[model samples]
Target: MPIRMHDTLRRKKVDFSTIEAGKVSMYVCGVTVYDRCHLGHARCYLSFDLIHRWLEQSGFDVHYVQNFTDIDDKIIHRANELDGDWKKLVDENIETYYEDMDALNILRADDYPRCTDYVDDMIRITADLIEKGNAYVADDGVYFSIESAPEKYGMLTGQILENVRSGAGGRVDDTGKSKRDHKDFALWKAAKPGEPTWDSPWGAGRPGWHIECTAMSMDYFGAQFDIHGGGHDLRFPHHEAEIFQGECHTGCSPVVHHWLHNGFVNLDGEKMSKSLGNFWTINEILKKVDAMVLRFALINAHYRSPIDMNDALLNDAERNYNRVLECYVTSLKGCLAENNVPLPVADFASTNPLSKSLALLEKMGEGFAKAMDDDFNSREAVAKVLGAVREIMKMHNSDMDAVDSNAFSHYAIDWLEETAGAVLGVLPTREMALAEPEEDPRKLEIADEVDALLLARTQARSDKDWAKADEIRDALHQMGVVVTDTAEGPTWDLA
Candidate 1:
C-alpha cells in the first residue's frame, strides 16, 4: 500500500507523495537550546525519527532537517541569571542535547540549522515580507501584518479572521506593542539592553521565534518542501505565522506539502509542565532507566496520542522491552550455534511448526509495514514486533531440534533484527549490547555470586526443594536479577 500520513492542515490522512520522486525533504522544528530536553521533546523528535527510518526503509531518500532556536528569550534570561554569555550557554546546551539524543539512538538530521547562524537570511526574508506589504516595521520591531494577507492567514489553524480576537485568546499577546493588528505577531524584535543583538535593517535586533524556522527551512529545503513538523502546540500562531510569511515571500499557496504535529507528553493527566515540577528531562530519566527502555516507552504510543509519563507506564515498558530483547538474544545464539547450516527449502513450504513460524514472521513484517505506512503508527508497529518475537520464541523452543539447520530460522532472525533493531531502533546490535567490557573487580565478584546462587537454585529445584529455590529466587530478585523458567532451562536477566 502507498504511504499515507495525517496532515494537520487538511485535518485528514492523505496519500503521502514527495515533491521530488523517491525523495523527501522534511523539516521538523527542533529545540530552543536554552535548557535540557524533556520527555515532550523526546516524543516529538522520536516520532520524526521513526518517520525518517521508515521512509528510508521504504526506499525514499529522505533529507531530514531540524533547526535549533539557539537565540531565544529563555536563553538570554538564563544566561543573565548565570552571569554568563548567552552564546556560551547555548553552546553548552547544544552539546548536552546531542548527548541526550544520541543516547536515545535518534538518527541525526541531515542538517541542523541554528537560528543564530541564519540571521542574515532571516533579515532578507523579513525585508522581503515588508516589501511585499505583508509586514510592517514598528517602533519596537517588525511584525507580520495578519490583515495584509487575510485570505492565507488562518488557513493552517482554520480560524475565521473577523471572529479572531486581538490576542487570539491568549495564544498570542499584542499588548503594549506597535502593530496594525493585535493578531499580527513579531517577525523581528528590537534588541533590548544587554540582549544579544545582530545588525539588521530593522536596527540591532534578533529574529522572532516563528521567523527563525521559516528562514532556516527555506535556506535548506527552498521555498517549498515535502513536510513541516513540530509539537502540536506549534499549530497555532507559530506555524500559522510561518505559513503566512513563507507564502507571502515566495508567492506560493502552501509553504509545505504536509504539516505533521506529534501530540504533547502528559504527566499525571495534565500536560508536562516545568512550572508544575512534573516534567522530567531526558537526562534525569536516563539516569534512572536504560535509554532503550525509555525510547521504547516513548514510541509505544501513537505519535499523535499524548503519552502519560508515570512509574507504572515505564515499568510496563521495561518488562515488554526485556521480552523483545531476550527473544532476539536467544535467536542470535541459535544462529551462531547452527552457523553455515541451511534448512531444506522444501521444509519451509511444508505444513509444520517451522513453516508456520515463518508464515507468522512474514505476517508480522507485513503488519509492521502496514502500521508504519499508515501515518507512521509506531505503537502498532511495536505490537507487531512483540507478536513476532513471541511466535519466534515459541518456534525456537518447540522446533529447534526438528529445524536446527533450517535457513528459515536464520532468515527469521535476520528479519527480526532488521525490523526491530534497525527500523524501530529499539534493539541494539549484539556487538553493542552484548560485547564484554573491561570488568570491575567488584562487579565480577557480584556476577560470580549471582551465578553461584543461580546454580544452587537450579539444583534445589531439581531436588524438589521448592522452599529453598523460592528463597534463592527472592534473594536474586532483591539483587536486581529476574529469573524465568522455560522448557529448555531457567534463564535470568537483570531487573
Candidate 2:
C-alpha cells in the first residue's frame, strides 16, 4: 500500500501528496538546549526519526528541518546559575544533544537552525506584523493582537471565546498593554537587564517561543509545508499559538497541511515530569540498557500510545531485541558454514510455499506502511517486522535435505537483514552477537563439562550405544549447549 498518514488538522487519514511533486519538506520542533535530553525527548525524536526513514525508503526526497531555541529563558537561567556565558552554555548542550542522538542512530536533519542565528528574520516578521496592524509595542514587550485574527484565533485548540476570555483573565496583566482581550500573546519579549537581546525596530528584545518556529520553518520550507510534527503536549499553547500567529501574518488559511503529534511518555502510569522526580535522562538510561535496546523499547508501543518507563517493561524490550539479533546471527552462522550455497534469484514466477513466506513479508511491509502513515505508528510497524522474524525463524528450522541448497540459498537471511537493518536499524555482527571468548564464568565451566560429556558420547556413538548418544545430547542441552547432528558428527555451541 502507498503511504497514507493521519492528518491532525482534519482529524482524518490522508496520503502524503506534496504541494510540490516528488519532494517533501518536514519541520519538527527541536530541543531547547538547556538540559540533557531525557526519555520523553527520546520518545518524540525517535518516533520522527522512524517516520523520516520510512519516507525516504518509500521514495520521497525529504528535506527535514529542526530548530534549536538556544536563546530561551531556561538557558539564561542555567547560565547565570553556573556563572557561565549564555552562548557557551547553549553551545555545550547542543553538542551534548547531538552526541546522545547520534548514539541512538538518528539521522542528522538537513538543517538545525538556531533562534539566535535567525534574529534578523524574526525582526523582519515582527515588522511585517506591526505594519499589518496585528501587533503593537508595550512598555514591557510587543504583543500580537488577537483581535486582528479573531475569525481563526481558537480554531486549532477547539476553544470558544468565553473559555479563552475566562482563561485569559487569570494570566493577563491589563496594567501593561492596551489590549482588547487577554487572549493576545507575546510576539517579542522586551529586553530585560542582563538577558540576551538584539536591537529591533520596537526596542532591544528577543522573539517569543511560538514566533521562533513560525519564522524559522517558513524561512526554510516556505509559508506552508507537507507536515509538522511534535509531542502531543505541544498541541495546545505551542502549536495552536504557532498556527494562529503564522496565519495572521501570512494571511494564509492554514500554516501546515498536516500536523502530527506523538504520544506522551509516562512513568508508572503517571506523566513523566521534572516535578514528579520520575523522569530519567537518556544518557542515564543508556548506562542501564544498550541504546538500541532503549530505542526498541520506545518503538515497541504505537507512537500514539502512552509508554511507561520502567525496569520490567524495558527488560521485556531487551529480550525482544535479542530475539531479532539472534535471527541475524543464526543466519550469519548458516551462511558462513554453507559458503558454497548459491545466491537467491529475487523472482517468484512459480507457485511455491516460499512464495507464501514472501507474500507474508510483503503484507508485513504494507501493514507497517499503513500504521506509520497513520500518524507514525512505529510500535505497530515494529510489530510487523517482528512478524517477519517469526516466519524467518520457521524457515530456518525447516529441513535442508528436502530442498535444493541452490534454491533457498541465502533468501531468508538476506530478507531479514535487509528489512531489519533499514527499518528497525538493528544489525548485529557475528562476533558481537554470538562468537566471543567466554568471559562469563558460568558459561566457561559449563563448556568444559560439556566437552568431557561429548568425548564419552562420541565413544558411545562409535560403540553403537544409540541410547547413550541420545542421553548425552539431551544432557548437554540441559546445560545450555545447543546440539545438532552434522555430517561431521554432532556439533554443539553454548546457548
Residue range 162-281, candidate 2, lDDT tens digits: 675444444432333544556777778888788878888878878877889988999988788888999988887788778877887888867798888888889988889889888889
* Shift of residue 468 alpha carbon in model 2, Å: 21
lDDT of 1 by residue, 88-186 (tens): 888899999999999999999999989889999989999999998988899989988877878876677788887776553444333226777788888
RMSD of each: 3.2, 5.5
Backbone clash total for model 1 is 2
Alpha carbon deviation, residue 494, candidate 1 (Å)? 7.5
Per-model TM-score, in order, reads 0.90, 0.83
Model 2 spans > 4 angstroms off:
165-180, 336-356, 401-409, 428-495
Q: What is the Cα root-mean-square deviation between model 1 and the actual structure?
A: 3.2
Task: Give the alpha-carbon lDDT of every model.
Answer: 0.86, 0.78
Looking at model 1, residue 177 earns an lDDT score of 65
Candidate 2 displacement at residue 322 in angstroms: 0.7
True-vs-predicted CA distance for residue 456, candidate 2, Å: 15
